[model samples]
Every structure is written in structure tokens, then in C-alpha cells.
Target chain A: MMGLHKKDLNLLLIVMVLALFAPFILNPFPTDSALAQFNAGYPDLMQRFVIFGIFAVGFNILFGLTGYLSFGHAAFLGIGSYSCVWMFKLLSYNVVPGILLSVVMAGIFSVAIGFISLRRSGIYFSILTLAFAQMSFAIAYSVLSNPAFNLTNGETGLQVYASDPQWLQSASAPNAPHLFGLPMRATETLTVGGWDFQFNVGYYMCAIIMILAFYLSIRIFRSPFGLMLRAVKSNQQRMIYTGLNTKPYTLAAFIISGMYAGLAGGLLSAMDPLAGAERMQWTASGEVVLMTILGGAGTLIGPVLGAGFIKYFENIFSKINDNILHQWFSALPDGLEDFLITIVHPFIGKGWHLTLGLMFMMVVIFLPGGLVEGGQRIGAMFKRKPKDTNGGLSAPATPAE
Target chain B: MGILEVKNVNKRFGGLQALGDVNLDIQENTVHAIIGPNGAGKSTLLNCLIGKLEPDTGSVTFDGQPVLGLKPHQINQLGISRVFQTPEIFSDLSVLENVLIPCFAKRDGSFRMNAIGTVGNETDVMSTAEKMLDDVNMLDKKDVLSGALSRGDKRRLEMAMCLVQEPKLLLLDEPTAGMARADTNNTIELLKEIKASRDITMVIIEHDMHVVFSLAQRITVLAQGRPLVEDTPEKIKGHPKVKEAYLGETAA
Candidate 1:
């Protein structure tokens, strides 16, 4: 009996159109131009856009709706990646089974972790999740990766070995994870005039999955279950008195989000065909948290935008080296150019994290609703009249619907 | 037996006895008001009925089912809903949403994964929530954020939230506690309207003599955590012990 509301349907349609034409939209710079380096139409970064979008969207379900900020979601992402790789090594090169197995494995992990962590709420809940993730990271980093065990393949990361069974495919089929005979790494570059756009198989696959994830998230946001989650955030004590058991609802959300991380991990390995223990690190968890917070925690489109913003900044800003700075400065007067380069030096190249931290601080301070709120403010400027008088509270949108 | 029965219910915090052998039998379909001074264990007894606290050694039953050891949600499921002194509506949700939550609790039980079903698409839920809001005269503010409403309106929304579940016994811990006189009178009128229409029994813990006189059929006066008298409102109005218990509160 459930269907999308008109507004929700419109949102889904808009996202779909944008994703379908992303190759053209993202490759605005011509191939001959110096700005082409900033063009993000390639397979690797494009795949990352949708994959991390999944990760952020899932994290939003737990943190945004429940107000239970988890600090260890990346453990699920790592477990997902490892599960996908083990599937490749044991089952076949087909991606369908890998994604399914990874989700199941992550669900199993989340059940164990969520069961223990959900015993507490607030900062205590966050700390319990952090402790669990740190433990997962430690085990994956050393104990599981040791030669005696070698479950994670240690510092070298995990990849499909030629010696493995790969029961569904012959050893000669291909080393990379694929969908039937279709290679996930395949891409076609289209050149018109001076513009070059990449149409990637893996990127499209990730885009489809991200779209599905977004749709499901939209449903959850509008569903009675999502209402309960917002209730948990708004007032847990009231909910208990209302006769709603919050623990199971929260655990279900945690598991669903964990599965989303698993799906993202599966997509990542499908494209790159590798898994590393570094994916389980606390910083990785922090990155997804940053994505959700930076986009707008509870909004449906906020997490995707946050993921794209962080990944795009990481890719484009980090590529600006000293040589490139000097070239730009050569056009300016000698002294001023040198001064500008020196000032901008720490925020680019290897210092993208410094830039990221500053942006996060500024966003947290001025635009606490993240990019979505910033977009709303700029949008309200054109409209010139306040849409609703009661948006004065910290809640920017109505639980994202 | 009355709908709610509390027999020799005792609760202690360390050496201080919060309630010592409290006994009360609240009749069905009647407005019962428990009037006492501050620290008379009114809220403590309310907590015991709602499963927020367990009595040290006694039985509290609602409709023949024991309620002392049940969890808060389970007690709620047992058809006992309490409205807090301060308005406890979901601040972040819209007014309609605040009402619809209890509708879900009534229809779907404690927990059900109705995640894929759009709230707008659920016609029965929408109508039930709409009717409840209309009853509270909050239909105009259905789309407004609950936290943005004034204190009086928040109290109305809280009442709507409780009423939507159609609980058998409604425990109100000073429903009109901090309201202005006009708002307090309005709340009394609302209570009278609800009492006339619904098949419900209300146990209101109140300090305001005006509200107690306006709505209560039977009154229980407690002083120092012990019941001083149980009688009709007219009799209790002239009782010496009841006057002394209140005079002490004013003098202190």
C-alpha cells in the first residue's frame, strides 16, 4: 500500500536524471584545457562517488534519524570488502553473489556489534561503537592478517589468487570481479570536438545501486519506522511511555545501514577488485561521518552530496602540486604570486585534510545543516520570502521528506 | 474491583520511605483525582502504576492484570498511558506526526516494520490522526512543528497523542501545572468534554484546587505519603485533615 508521495517521487526523478547525465555534467572542461585535471568523468572517481554515497546514506539512517551517532561504521565497510573478496576467492568472479554474501556477512557482524553497543545510548553508545570498531581494526590489522591466519591478506591487501577454486568460472575467465561476461572495469571514452567523456560500465552499475539505495532510504524516511526513529531522536523517554520498544527499532536501523556499507564495499571491490585493512580504520569511519554531517544529516540527498563534495575535493584539490602553483603564479607579479602560493600551499596537495578540516569547521559554525542548508539559504534568497515560519529550530527539513 | 487497584504498595529510596503501604481502588469510568501537597508520593504512586518504578513489596493491578514489574512500554500496551507534567511531545516532528505515532501504536502494536509504507498513503491512519487532532482543536496546527507551539498548545498536542491510543486509564501528573489561569480553565473544559464522550477513567494528580473541584468525582487526599481520606469531593472539601495538609504546604 506504500508509494512515494509526489514530492518524494519528484526528488527521485531529479536524482535519476542527474545521475544518468553525470558523465556529461562532470566533464565540463575540455580535454585540451588545463582544467581537465579537475574533470571527474572517469570510471575510478565516478564509481567512488556512488559507492561512498551509499556509505553516507546508510550512516544517515542511524545517526540522523536516531540521534545515535556511531563512530565505528567503517568496520562494516571493511567487513563488507573482505566478504566480497572471500566470495571471489571461494565462489566465482560474478559480482551478484559477492554483493549478497558481503551484505549477509556485514549483517551478521552488525547483529553482534549492535547487540552489545545498543545497551547504551548518547555518547556512551558512540564510545561503545568506537571501541568495537577499534577492536575490529586491530584484529584485521595484525591478528587476522598474520601468515599463520592471513584472512585479510595483511599489508598487501586481498585479491583473487590464481590458485583459488573460483567454482563458477575457469581460472582463465578473468582475475577481476565481473557480472557474468561483462567486465566491471570496462569503459568507453567518447571524444567530440575538444571534449572527452568517459562512459563506464562500473560507474553505471554503481549508479543503479545508489539509485536503489536512495529510493529505499526515501521510503524509510517517510515510513512509520522512520517516524519511530525520529521519535527516538526527538524523545526516547516519550516513546517508551508511548509503548514503542526502541532497542529493536534502533538495532534494525543499525543492521540496515551496516548492510548498506556492505553493498558499498561490494561495489568498491567490483570496480577495484581489492580489499585492505585500512578500510576498517577509525579515520575511514570518521570520513563517512563527515560526509553525513557535511551534507545535512537527515536530508535524503544530503549524504550523497556530502560524499561527492569530499571525494571531489580530495581528488581535484590534492592534485594541485608546487609546479602547478608556480605556473599560475608566473602570470601574477613575482612577489605577490610567491606570497599567494605560500599561503595556499598548506591547504592543497598533501594538505587536503587541512582544507577539509577548515571547511568542516566553517560549515559546522555557519551552516550547521551542511550543504543542504547552504543550498536552502541561497535558494531562499531568490524567493525573498520565508517559506515556513517554524523552520527556526535546528531541524532544517522534516526528517528529510 | 475498580479498574486500577493499588494494595499495600510500598517503595523506598535508601532509608527514606517514599510510599509506605499505599492502598487505592480507582473505580471504572469515573474521574478520580489524587490531591496532595509536594512530596506526598503522588508522582511516585503514578510511576508505580505506569511501571516506571517497582514497589518494594506490593501489588498494582490494572484491569485484573498485575503491572508492577512490567516495562514502561509493556505497561503502555496494557492500556495505561501517562501524560507528563511537562509537555513531552516529539519536538522535532510535526503536530500530525506526534498524533499519528500513537495511532501506529494502537493499530500496529508496539513494533512493526512499516518502513516502505508512505504515511500519506495510509488513509485510515491519516483519518484517525486527523479526527484526534480535530478533537483537540489542533487540526490547524497539524503541519506545524510541535516544539514551535506555545506551552498550552503543546499540552493539547500531548493530550491528543495520549487520547489517540484510546488507553483505558489515563494518568495525568499535573496536566495544568504551569499554565496561566485561562489555559488551566481551558484544560479543565477539555477534560470535561473528554470525560463526557469517551469510555475512559482518569486519575489526575493535581495541586490546583480549582481543577480538582471542576472535574473530579471521587477524591483521595494523601499527606506525608499516606492516604488521609477517600471520599466524594464535597466531603473532602470540608475535611480538617485535608485542610491541615494543604495549610502546611502554604505555610511552609
Candidate 2:
């Protein structure tokens, strides 16, 4: 009663089922089949889904409920990665300390940023956060990379160094990052009939973390703190007048969201033990925004769904080459085959971003509430939802439901 | 002793004196109205009292606590709530949530991180908000978005949000500013009902003579950033200064 509503419990069950069976669901293409190239059961891509899901879920907490569009959340992500990597370099290959430190470090950083940026609202808040993030990027690029510090390692990227002291690590232990003796790189491949499902340890770890993150987000969404954030979004004018010091509530949400991004970043390093200044760029921050909006903001499941959808498009769409296109249209007549390839060329491989942009545009225009709203709209139509003309008052409406 | 004491309050905006030496003792549990013609510093004085604008040199004390340097929320925590000229309900939240915001603030103060605690199951908060909504006759439509509410309903929702806090002083700035006469009457009835049921003091800045005369026990007339007169509503209606400064040519 204090945590999940019945509906939210159902959502959690659905997500758990999906995540538990994704290896099978995503590997539908049989081994050695022509479509095998499209198989997303690989560990790398699955890990990305859960990781970015964490990122988007965190972003949604700030942007969705509070309507504070932070254009620099990726700075926290980059900082998380850097902190995690530093943990790996100085301590050992264990991910526990790295992940813990990442969240804590991101929390500290966000508190400072939130205290400063939350003084302004609307586009000004966005600009302030963006400027702080850009400054962080610059510091990571040059200042921190200098011989006096060299914290970020500049453009070369920071990674585990064999020469560095790993005091807690046993010489007998595997050099890669791991939980105790279980390496994140371990994979268990199952072959049934012609299909092959590969379940990787890293994916499961990320999946478990993502589920916890989602659960925390759902709790926050339904919490009193969350209601305050939504009130802040709805009308700061009313909020201030209602005796609510809105700044602290917003700052708390911002820091929590930043910690979410940090968790995502920590997981990134945990899975692949690397950190780069480019990870903190504004484009990365924009990606999380796109993921949240494209999936549907303010909904419990939207951010994760959005994260998976975008990652799926990025991975699958970017893998299709001209040769694959020719193969797809080979049976057609020469003129038609050539024409189709020409038309489809710009939207595949290097042009996958173009397809993504168009899809996002369509989503924004036709489905303002994003994919979750679309699902609800369909559900509402089928369920014959009652039209709310309460007391026969003609009221303006939107996806407020 | 007065619940609210405004002493030597002066506010200036650039070269224009918005309020000059404004002093008033707002008694407990009384519906007091401050009426004036346009540009008569009524709104400015209200702003100073609510901590929106600080007086150049003066003090505002609510329940004898200095409120001059306090933030808006801090002042609110001292039991002061204001309803704007236009309805200022949380437009994006559901009707129930608009009322719940203040309940949370009332219980938890201005800032809290009880992020994991559920709102609906807080039985205490839910029942309080529901009771307030019921009082405002909006219990049935609590799930509707506040933005979608009719003008009269929005006003009702705002009143519910304010009164739910059960502040010691309620500040209403032109509560019926944009309403039709029918809606204005409805608001008047609602305000009367609210006042009769609770021992709450109210400070209202108004332009409507009808509303002022109908509800106010005592009226203060402000003219050109100065208090023209303060007296019983009946006495103020016949006062020559009020007639000259406000009623103008209609000095009967």
C-alpha cells in the first residue's frame, strides 16, 4: 500500500518478464539465417538498453515531474564514469566501490549544480545547467588532463592501468572488472533448434540494477516529494504562495535524477571499464531527453520503454548496409531495386540518425505524450473509457490522464 | 493585540510612492476589506504584508512575529495564505493534488525528501484533502485536471487549497476580479460560508463596492498611497473623504 499501486505492480511484473526473457525475445532470428545480423541478443547491446534506461528514468524524474529541462545531465554521467574508473585504477577491479562512489560523487556534484541552476527556472535553468556541463566538459578536456591533475586523462580516455596500484586485487584474480570471481564478461549461450539465446552476466547485472532504479523511480513518482515536484511544474506561482519553498524540493529531485545518471555511467564503466570526456557532451544529455519524451514523460514505464526503443533503433538501423539493402530488394526488377535502394539509402547505416530524427518528429507532432500515451490511447479506445463531462462543464483537456 | 500589525510600512517603485506610512491592525477572525480606486496602493500594501515586496522602512508582524525579512513560504508557515486575483491552482495537477500540495507543506514544512512515502496511503493527508474538497463542493471532480476546471470551479479549488491550510490570516486579492455577476455572487456565498464555519481572519484587497459592503465588518480606504480613512463599513459609505477620493462626483 505504501509503495506500488496495483497498476504499478502489474507494470513492474511486465518489465521483469520482458527483461528476464529479452535474450529469447530478441534472438528470434535463427542462427546462420540471413536475418541473424539483426539479432540483438548480444551482451553489449542488451547492457546498453538497461544502462540508458536508468539514465532516461533519472532524467524523467526531473524533466517530467518538475518540468525542469536540464540540458546537461550527461555531465553527471561522465563524472560517474570517471569516478568509477578511478576506483578501478586506484583500488581493484571490483565494481562495488566504483558503483557506490559513482552515485555519491554524482550526488555531490549535482547538489552544487542544482543549488546554482535552480535559482532560475524555464529556459534560463536549462541554460545554466548547460553552461555548467560545458564547463565540466572543458575541465575534463584540458584542465583536469594537465600534468598537475590528469584526472580525466584528456582525449585519450581513462581506463584500468595494469601498472597502477590495485591494492585489494589478488594476483590470482582476473584482471577485468568483476563481482568477486564472477567476471561481467562471462556469457552462457543456449542453442535450441535453430535459434541461439546468449545470456551474459553483464546484461543480468545491469538488468537487476535497472529494475531497482525503476522501482525507486516509481516510488518517487507516487511519493509526496514527487507531488511537490509536479506542483512546481504545474505552477511555481501557486507553489510559492501555498507556503512551499519550491527550491529545495526541486533541488532534491535534480540531485536524485543526477544520481540516476551517475548510476547509468557507473554501470557503463562496470560493463566496459572505460570513461571519456565525450560521454559528458550535450548530445548525450539530449539523447536522454529524446528517450524520455519519445517514450513518454511522467509515466513510470515510459522512460525505460523509450530507452530500449531508441537503443534498438540505433543498433539495428545502423547495422543495415547497402549490401544488405540490395539483398532485401534483390528479387525485384532492376529499375525498382535500384530506385528502392536509392530512396532507402539515406535512412540506413550512417543515415540511421536521419530515420531516428524523422521518427522523433512524428512522435512529437502526432503523439505529444509519446509512446506510453499512444498505448493508453489505444487501450482507452478498446476499453470505451467514459467521457468526463463532469457536471456538464466544458473543460479543455489533454493527456492529463 | 492585533493578529497582524503593519507599522510605518512605506514602499516606493522608482520615483512613484506605491505606499506611504501604511499602518493597520488586522483583528483576529474578522473579514476586513481594503477598498480603493485604481492606482491607490491597495495592491502594493497587500504585497508588502505578504512579503512579496519589502517596505523601504517599516515592519510587518503576524501574531507579533516580524515577517518583513521572512521568505514567502516562511511567512506562510507563520499561518498566512494568499489567493491571487486570478486562480493560481496547480494547473497541471489533478484537482485533488492541487489541494494535497499545501497539506504536505503544512505537515512537513517547506522542504522534505520523503520520496519513498506514498501520497494516497497517507490516510491522514488523503482524508484532510478530501474533506477540504468536500467543503468546496469539488469532492466529486477531484481527479479532473485543475487546468480543465471552469472559472468558478477553479476559484472554488483555490479557496479549498488556501482554507485547507487553515491559516490564521487569509489574503484575497480581487477574488472576484474577472467573474460574471452571477459567478461573483456564488463566490460571495462561498466566502460567507467559509467565514461562518471557521474562526479565520481575512484581509481582502478589493475594488467591488458591492462585495466590500456585503462582507466587510470594517473597511480601510487607501487613496494616493495613503490611508484615506478606516472605519465601520456603514460609516465609510457616508464619509466625505471616501466620497471625494473614491466615489468622486457621487458624494451624496
Clash pairs, candidate 1, are none
Candidate 2, residues B1-252, lDDT tens digits: the string is 789998988888999998989899889999999998999998889888888888999888899899998888889999999999999988877888888989988998888888988887899999999999998888888888788888999999999999999999999999999789999999899999999999999988888889998899989999989988999998998898888997576763
| Fnat for each predicted structure, in order | 0.73, 0.78
Q: What TM-score does candidate 2 get on C-alpha atoms? A: 0.97
Q: Record all residue pairs in model 2 with backbone atoms less than 3 Å apart, i.e. clashing.
A: none
Give all TM-scores, in the order shown: 0.97, 0.97
For model 1 the TM-score comes to 0.97
Docking class of 2: medium
Lowest lDDT 10-residue stretch of candidate 1 chain A: A388-397
User: Cα deviation of A398 in candidate 2 (Å)?
Assistant: 12
Error of model 1, residue A356, in angstroms:
0.8
lDDT of 2: 0.90
Query: Can you write out model 1's per-residue Cα lDDT over B124-222, one digit (the tens) per residue?
Result: 999999999998898877888788888988988998899889999999999998889999999999989988998999999999999999999999998
Residues A1-401 of candidate 1 have per-residue lDDT tens digits of 23787778888887787677889988999997988888998888988998999999999999989988999999999999988888898888888888898899989999999999999998999999999999998888888887677898888888988898878786566557778767888889899999988998889988999999999999999888999999999999899999999999999999999999988987788787799988989999999999999999988889999999999999999999988899877989999998999999999999999999999999999999889889988877898665545555323327543
